[model samples]
Target: MAKYKLPKPGELSSSINYNPPAKDWMDIPVEFKPATYPAAAKEKDLLTVGFPNAHQWTPEDEDWNLPDGWEDTVIKGIEERLSKYRSFKLFMDVCVRCGACADKCHFYIGTGDPKNMPVVRAELLRSVYKRYFTKAGKVLGRLAGARDLDADVLKEWWYYFFQCTECRRCSVFCPYGIDTAELTIMGRELLNLLGLNINWIAGPVAACYSKGNHLGIEPHALKSNIELMIDDIEDITGIRVNPTFNRKGAEILFVTPSGDYMGEPGIYTCMGYLMLFHELGLDYTWSTYASEGGNFGFFTSNDMAKRLNSKIYAEAKRLGVKWILGGECGHMWRVLNQYMDTWNGPADFLEVPVSPITGTRFENAKSTKMVHITEFTADLIKHNKLKLDPTRNDHLRVTFHDSCNPARGMGLFEEPRYVIKSVCNNFFEMPENTIREKTFCCGSGSGLNATENMEERMRGGFPRANAVKYVHDKHGVNMLANICAVDRAAFPALMDYWVPGVGVTGTHELVANALVMTGEKERTTNLRGEDLPGKEGNE
Candidate 1:
């Protein structure tokens, strides 16, 4: 739990100040407050993932207990990455510091911290890059905006890099199109070399590595969780959905974040998936081995991300599933669309995904050989393959939130909206500036959604909550729909803190609510056991 209680909405909102302070950003030292940042990664979690310098340390202590030659390790890690990724070097070199990205970051908008500005955040690393890697920086020193890589600078890197959600909204505004998120990724990678990682990220990475899911749910436990959802489906619809796990020769392999099965609200979304699959008579199987669709390792380092992501393809091949259907998640799709092929490529064993129901080939996913659930559902709705009763969601005045990875990384704008409008009677959009490619992060993304950092999470989520408040007040929106699991887990707290009464849900939960399944008894209550609009008396 957070050490301090969050202020009321009025005081918190009134506390934001966008103005920069009198001193240069470099002159300002980072203060390690208890609740403002996430806790340091535990030694055991670091050891589980084979990270270096496995030892106990707190961010507040002057001694971080870095291993001998830790500075050399970070410098060499930066040099290796500079030599490897062209984008890293290009981003380091190309920023003109025009301040176009200063106001664009949600963290900057909410916290009013100058270092949270994307340009300045990138400069935190670029300063070291300039001092060590560039001739001009080596000659001119501070004159060229270069600073030495010292312990204080490393601490600053740990603080601010973890502060970022890696949402990439800043990259959209940059004239040079510098991806500040990738810069943060690189910064985190360097930090990982010295075993400087947050518990929120490292714990999940370690769990996903050994237990095959972020929650460390064992194979039998994973099956039990789904079976519980199956039982609930029976209770709601009077229809039994028997989903297979680790079954061989299935036509499609279904993968979703473990939260969808294990966590509240996300479990409702999981029920939606089971109901939809049962109605379609689709041939799909779940894998306990590839249980987690989200790759928390992406928040740690690229190598760790690849290590965690390899399980999906491995499971797909072993099961002999013809194609893969992914559930709603933010960074999972980013990894799939952008980095998966490069990291664990070819997916030669699996066939290109074709909707068994609609017969529409997913040409977009031909290479990745995996299709998003919304893309699959939108196609089904397009062909009128499933009967739907939109009024089941009449109780919800719904608005769609575009998860950052899908909107920016994958260009998935209309499919989710199309699905949402088809299922719900009343659908509204947040301000155009706060949606689609320009969407604000849910604030607790990229493993920043830890309980210890409640204040920070609330601060970062303010811009997004403000946008939701607009539609909530104007359009009477009661439910916020999104495709990301992190949004499902993060938004409830955000809404409670910032805009009370706006509930969060996944897209498919609404879909299943509106789905008119074959031979289903009168659904008096929706999946959450809430009464339908006119069926209130019956429930």
Candidate 2:
């Protein structure tokens, strides 16, 4: 749209630059200029969650008006976290600065910002850790790569930390097994100490805390949204289905991210979920409360994550369900799989999640008693539980982009592809390295999917988008499928920016399109209301 500083003529490969300019890291001027997208937290958004320091603020404002004892607050916060999480201490201590993981980051590969590199991003905190805690840093100082926690350092943390999508792709390449995501989370938590947070993250967190879901959809609105979805279902399949809400003694309690009830692609995916469950005759009730599976809380802090995630179990127990069927989401599963059991409880009330129809036990989710939508669909496909017409998606040349958290954090790589391949006729994977655990982020994961950060999101999204472009050109791919809500929300912009012809959607949205329901009217359109490829102009 405008003439920007174009890259040098020969700047072709991302491998071209792994080393920063020849200067001391601290002396290197970090310019958070027009290139850096600035988005600040809104007071109204934070007010619901009772953020005491929440007031009108902007990233461009010079006076952030941090608390009086801000330096001490940060030091103490780091100390407490270090003491609590051994992983933090180990990550701080273990890095050898070999730069093996440097090129692996999506932001660094996309923006060429050295600080975006996982090693250097961690160094933002690691420098503070060395200054306050480490012995070598106390004596050697810059020689030991330690730096002070001054204003500039704080600003740098705010800038680059959000640049990370908390995608652990870097961790996959690290020889030391260092996780930059954990460091990024620690950075965000420390920044939140000074009441510094973005509006996108703070807003959803507050909404989820009070209104039961991230979009702040209350009981009435939640019911209304589903009513609209049921209307759409009837229009397509010629069958009206009734799903329960907060009904006690239900066999399964279904929960999806709040975005599913409100946002695009997500709402379409939600329609797919409803139609699939209706066809299976699965006895499941919905919950107006705990309507979110994508935990924005996980992006904030462990306490906030625990606070928001507590609803799922609370609602499940209240509804008297045997197990929870979680929808397709990114960080939500990471929390559900890794943190929920440890943070919330043994969940002794709910029974282990087993498919009552197929009788398949999810032993991996035995502790949490939660099943992923893909896993559920895969099981159903394996059993031929639903008649699927893969040819319905013949026009959609699909490729799967593994969302970072579920791919790296939980290792849910195969189940989603199995479901996608089972539902769609043609399937392609973005290069071998970029498809599975080493997959890049959507450039807008965590809480970085704000509109103000569009430019930065475009840059961070390049690696993932570039891979999509490769597949788009080679495989004639048009539909880029994923299971993450953030991807569904953010990738349209990315697709338009980098890979213009390609589109992003949820895996189950495709399944719902291809599924042949019992005694349903002959379908002429897919879930998005698009005419089916071959079904067009047919009597």
Per-model TM-score versus the true fold:
0.96, 0.94
Give lDDT tens digits, candidate 1, residues 1-539: 66998799999878997765689889999998878899999999999989888899999999988888987998899999999999999999999989999999999999989899998999999999999999989999989999999999999999999999999999999999899999999999999988899998899999999999999999999999889988888998999998999999999999999889778789999999999999999999999999999999999888899999999999999999998999999999999999999899899898889998988999999999999999999999999998999999988999999999999999999999999999998999999999999999999999999999999999999999999999999999989999999999999999999999999999999999999999999999999888988998895
Lowest-sum lDDT 10-residue window in model 2: 29-38
Which portions of model 1 show Cα errors greater than 4 Å?
1-21
Residue 431 CA displacement from its true place in model 1, Å = 0.7
Which stretches of candidate 2 lie above 4 Å from their native place? 1-22
Please give the lDDT score at residue 406 for candidate 1: 97
Q: All models: lDDT?
A: 0.94, 0.87
**Candidate 2 lDDT tens digits, 350-393:** 99899988999989888899998899889989998889899999
RMSD (CA, angstroms), candidate 1: 5.8
Question: Clashing residue pairs, candidate 2?
Answer: none
Residue 141, model 1, lDDT: 92
